[model samples]
Target: MARGKEQPARRGGGGRAIGRVIPWAVIGLWVAAVAVLAPFAAGLDKVKSDKVVDYLPSGAESTTVAALEEKLPGGGVNDFVVVYYRAAGITADDRTTAERHLAVLDRKYPGPPTDSAPPSIPAGENGPHTVGADGDKTTGSSSRVQDSRDGKALLFAHSVGTASGEPSAYLPALRKLLEDRPAGLEAKVTGPGAIEGDIDAVFDGIDAKLMITTVIVVTVLLILIYRSPVLWLLPLLAVGCAALISMAAVHLLAKNFGVVVNEQSAAVLVILVFGVGTDYALLIVARYREVLQTEADTNRAMSVALRSAGPAIIASAGTVAAGLLCLLAADLNSTSGLGPVGAVGVACALIAMLTLFPALLLVLGRWVFWPKVPKVLPAGVTGAVAGQARWDRLGAWIDRRKGLAAFGSVVFLGAVALGLLGGPGSLRSQDQFVKTPESVSGFTLVTRHFPHIGGQPITVIAPTAKKDAVLEAAEAVKGVSQVVPGRSGAEYAEITVFPKDAPDSPAERRTLKALRAAVDKVEPAAAVGGPSAQNLDTATTSARDEKIVIPLVLVVITLILGALLRAVAAPVVLILTVVVSFAAAIGASTLVFEHIFGFKGIDPGLPLLGFLFLVALGVDYNIFLMHRAREESLLHGTRRGILGSLSATGGVITSAGVVLAATFAVLATLPLVPMAELGFLVAFGVLLDTLLVRSILVPAVGLRLGSRLWWPSALGRHTDPEDADGQASVPIGRERALRN
Candidate 1:
């Protein structure tokens, strides 16, 4: 087959050099990057930060409240009704006890607001009131709480806003006050903050849990790959610097540009830098190990490593960064900003892989593999079969059954592909985390007590040219079940339309259609907003975003891949493969959610995110594969070149896939269903990339391409043993050592 030693492969040079020298330099740069926004990350959310209170739930969804709702009061629960109590239970003495208790608890005022100005209280009177013209009162909180039916049970009622807003700051103090109560009557606080506080308490060790897991996984993987503690420190140093720089960059952008970044996302960013960066580091370090095994000259080996693996790493980085850019398509600002932060971080990791990592490798010299001397391969380095004694048998087998290998690979991928029949989750059954705390708790309570609980409310925002009276007029519109006053005085009222089902339910669609007709009947002037309106906005935004962002990301990725590979067809083919892989990933995610997780379909935005992530990272694997294939092609001609490249590159990509997929799979542990489903989908996608796309399809395609695979090139005709194209063909540094 003239397929002698699979193409002359390039070995390690840059990974070790950069591993040794650049981390120190990167330290300075990272600190400077941190200084770029140390003021911000340190204090971006310091002043009444919404991020601080946002996810905290009020007592409504607290476990205790849920337990109680399951017990008494006939049936329904008032989401998180704070029972205000002033009762003269059976006698004046009992009543005074109740009043004294309420005063001690300071239960009358509905808490203070951040502005120090009181929040406009809900229009309803606090429960039922007993009043005479003389302004007499024996009522309110007592009726709701203390005067239990048949006088056997007495409970008081009060009200509080959601924990996510200004109300949350002081909600804790209020709860503490209630807990410190007198005997006979228990002051039980149940609100949104209470629920969140409970979750926090229940999952107190979550951060520690995640950290321990990550460290254990990473340590094991690093030990396996680098085989040295020294090598471990190198990747950490590079990635730590990248993380600091990325965070600083994010803080700076948010501060200067007013781009809102949710605090919850900060955690996601930290994990991403470590996880993805580690994978990239593995690729570079492994290449260095390969290079060190061959050439005696440390510098030359390092250069060869860089020249050969550098393009692949750079290409991978570019693809990952560009894919993250696709996240900008998310209509929600909080989710959208995640894309760029990740993209920028990945970009930094790539640059460090090439520059700083190479510098460190140069400094470390042989010490990088300290504790174990570098293995020297003296057999003219016969591509895949030379020093990889580990996988000789497997390589030989693939060498023996090329057709069966290709067919089995394609068929296996197709089986996974069929899983794509299911679509991503539907908004109707969005994972539970998105439910309004009140809706969730109240639904539970009412379902237990009342045989019939009404459906979800479709909130209507009454828009106005003039702020004052528009809301009043809006409340009077037909088909509206109830009018809840909005924060804006009369300009924007929150009209609740209770449909037969929730907003995403088909029954709600009928309500929406009726509501639209009702709005149409209103004077031509008054503007309105409802779930239908929001849905329309979402659909339009989604469509427009797909049109613009998908193409933009694809174009950017193509350019970056082409530039890195120095080959047009390679990037184009890889991109196509990524696109197909992405579709299959999304399809698989949808099927999982619908069939296994019990969701109806995938999130509308899931495809875009999957496309962005898998495609971009998928490109990295592709580049890594082709670059290895191209290197092999140089020495082994076409046939052996393909075999050698596949064997050598397969292990690294597979390792990366396993590690990455495992890390993402941990997201399934999150209580939120979207995160769980997303985690599974991505984990599966990465697995598919490593097992099917990278190891199977990519090589099959490469083998089929033969010489045309590296076309329009000066090196195209130079693979004959007579022609010498040194990997470190041109020295790339200020000193001989740096030149490699």
Candidate 2:
């Protein structure tokens, strides 16, 4: 302990002021802030929108079409198909039961007019209408019911005015009605409308579900790590405050600034705040405990820990926030919105951990550590010297076998990266759910029975004057099975075009392109959009976002690392390793998704999101290591400094990594496949980085580079006795681990 420098900190000068007065004031201020902000935080879900158009790329044709649809009569309508199936055949009794259900539906919700574009027709109160018929001649001018040629399925199309309500509100009631049927007969309501409803159902209460799961996961992990009854609560409480502040900030941004907040972004915000906030808490507490081993006064010890660990925490948060903000450049609204949403979360977490968290610990003092309370050690002893023998030996072994360790790690990561060869294509909407919902089952039945025109209808908006020409042009397109004219506004008319293949199919994608080309030639102002078109645009925009946002994130991280380390080569090496780590993680995840989980493909936006998280977060461990090494190097030169820093930071960094990875893994508990895929990849990547890259590869590489790792800095050019062979003079195993 340096009495000369820390004497005032131990006395009643600044130390007493911080210990006695500031902590209560900080805690008081946080209490008031939470009271004022809690309602806004709770109101976050009110502003969250998962609408397709809300997340579509700005200026895309689909977005334009969506805007135009809102201006038309009935504000556009929800289209769906009701499929009835029987394995053997539709017997007389089965047909009778289907007719009864249809009649009930028709009477409850009457269609427009027989002449107008009515949604569907149910069997009537009129004379016994023929049941197993094909086409529009089923006793009503408003509806069309088609029986499959194989006599196994009956399919019907319907539309509901969006002005009436969202599909999410009404589809469940309709499905419930269909639930009561004869044995061996199956009924499913599915199409664009039902699919939308199913997706909505998944996100309905996601905020609450995600928050509860993440908090429980973090709480359990913290309790296990601390092994103290009381110590874990302070960090959990601080994280709760951070989450409240973050939700309020995001809600305000969405309400006032029009920043898009979707279910996915909101859910991710909760996980990120809890995970990253706890990580900062772990690092701060570890340093505080170490300082407490030598300093008698808790406040003074915390002051020292803050001074030592604060810069690394701030650098890490800044790097993550910067990388996330790079998504602002993306064309996809969802991707761009996530950038700020996640940044706000990181900022709130940083502030809460640095402020309220430290204040809570200081106010509670040494008693909080309980049974294993930190007692002051002898004058020269520190916590690291008394513990962490394994870390010391591991650092020494890596230091000695630098060449072999670095080469082996690179080879291992490269081999894992080879899993990318088994390509998983972009995910379809039908495949979005981990469990097959009723809508997906119905869609499959529809496709099986109606092969020619089974896909969701693509809506095209064209000038009313050119509607006829546009319809004719669309019908000429190769994949167009049918083109029906929908309602007409004063200037524009809607046209529904059905493709022969299923939605999200390659054939359907081709059909969309051809339809767009044909309609554009007839009416230059026309735009093509629907559920299928939205999917296509979303995939296209996500790919474009990857190209722009990913490189920007890399550049931002590199700059931050360069400034933090005050070196060129070290930052570059860290960036390269994180990038390779991301690749390997994604590749490994792809294999799992394909073979184990039976996922058809990954979400289009996943690549950008995963890369941003892994690269920024993977470098976080390296920043802690290299930052400490930089301080140590100024005294002992690079070789000994890195070895000492590795041993010093190894346990705390690994714990932080596990805490972060576990928090992200909570997302896998959700039903959405995208969330699960993202959760698994990030969790796996963080473990790989913590267990392999940070523990061995980075330290090994640093040793081989020696002083040159800090090139252009004075630390790099300095020569010490240990610089002769770029090895530590005394083996780390024989000495006490370096003091904090």
Worst 10 residues of 2 by lDDT: 731-740
Tens digit of lDDT per residue, candidate 2, span 1-740? 24334555236566567568989999999999999999999999889887777779987898988888777776656777788999998776766666666676666544433333643233323334443222233533333555665678776777776655778888888888887888889989888788889989888877888888888888898898888999999999999999999999999999999999998889889989998899999989988988888788887788889998999999999999999999899998888889999999999999999999999998888999987899998876655533479889998888778899999999999999999888579998889999999889988887776665546788898999999999999999998877767767888887878787778889899999999998888888999998889889999999888988889999999999999888898999899988888889999999998999889988998899999999999999999999998877765667778888887888888989999999899887788899999999999999999999999989888888877788766555544566636433433232223222
Off by over 4 Å in 1: 1-213, 375-411, 420-442, 450-453, 463-480, 484-500, 513-517, 520-548, 566-568, 591-604, 634-636, 708-740
The TM-score values for the models, in the order shown, are 0.71, 0.93
TM-score, structure 1 vs. true: 0.71
Cα deviation of 410 in candidate 1 (Å)? 4.5
Native-vs-model 1 lDDT? 0.54
RMSD of 2: 4.4
Candidate 1 lDDT over 461-517, as tens digits, reads: 344343235434445544443333322322322233334344455555555556555
**What lDDT would candidate 2 get against the real structure?**
0.83
CA shift of 266, model 2, Å: 0.7
